[model samples]
Target: MVLIVLGFIIFIAINVVVKNNPVAAKFAGAGRILALVFILLGISTACVKQIDAGEIGVKSLFGSIQNDIMGSGLHFINPLLDVKKLDVKTQNYTMSGVNDEGNKAGDDAIKVLTSDGLEVTIDLTVLYRVVGADAPRLLRETGEDYRDKIVRPITRTKIRDNAVYYQAVDLFGSKRDEFQQRIYKSIEDDF
Candidate 1:
């Protein structure tokens, strides 16, 4: 938009200058060419969008979201529309003491009280991805920061809720898988 305005300004200035001075006529032609270049460049750039591999593009016009989910590669879209890229690859959200590849390590491990009234710190690593087909719905419902807005809060809440159903010793030792499965089910239901 700025480019188009700048081009229009240059064209107006050139027209004014050429009428006053014949010597400036040659420079006016060059100025007109430069303005055309700016306008063309802006239009061409605005007409296309690129979605990276393992990502989905969500389109929006003004503030209203469109339902179409664009796959990886170059896509021709409305110049005025906005495209938001969302990573669809599996991401690891970790609550751990050490940082590792593919893991979003953080100090905020989940703490929950067991049936026995004992408190336990649960170090969890959740691997999840947004379904490409559901990308539009995800954007409409949760916006762009769905990981922070939906995933993290829901995962933490479900884990803490399920933890109270089991004994602390069972959660720490023998029945770990069962507890994990319950947490998984709870989180999956939300999606």
Candidate 2:
């Protein structure tokens, strides 16, 4: 947008100077050429989008979403549209009380009420990624910060919902795997 405005200003100056002086006429032509170059550069740069590896591009034109998901590489798109990049790489989020490297800490740990009316604190790690094909839909529904808005909320909710089905002791002992699997299934279904 800046480039387009700069080019227009230069074009106007070129026209104003062309009729005033013969000596400045040559410079005016050069100014016109420079303006054209700037405009072309702006348009060309905007039209070509580069999506990095393990990422997808979600294209939107005038706030309306386009269905196509751009894969990793350079793609030609409408110059006026906006392309938002979403990482498709598998991400690991740890929910824990102790702040470990690459893990989220503090009160983010899951707390749930068990069937026996006991409260339990569970630390969990979620390994997941955004589906490349669903990037467009995800962007349309959740915007750019889908991980915080969707992934965290859904995972936390599902864990709490499934936790109440088992005894607190079972959740920490023999039925651990079953509890984990149930939570996983519920979260997976939402995605």
List candidate 2 segments past 4 Å from native. 16-26, 99-105
**Pairs with backbone N, CA or C atoms under 3 Å apart (clashes), candidate 2:** none
Q: Score residue 47 of candidate 2 by CA lDDT.
A: 88
lDDT of 1 at 188: 91
- lDDT per residue for candidate 1 within 1-191, as digits (tens), equals 67877888888889998999889998987999998998888788888899999999989998788888899999988899999899999987776545453246445677889999999988888889999888888888889888788888898899999999999899979999999999999999986
Specify the poorest-scoring 10-residue window by lDDT in model 2. 98-107
Clashes, model 1: 0
TM-score of 1: 0.87
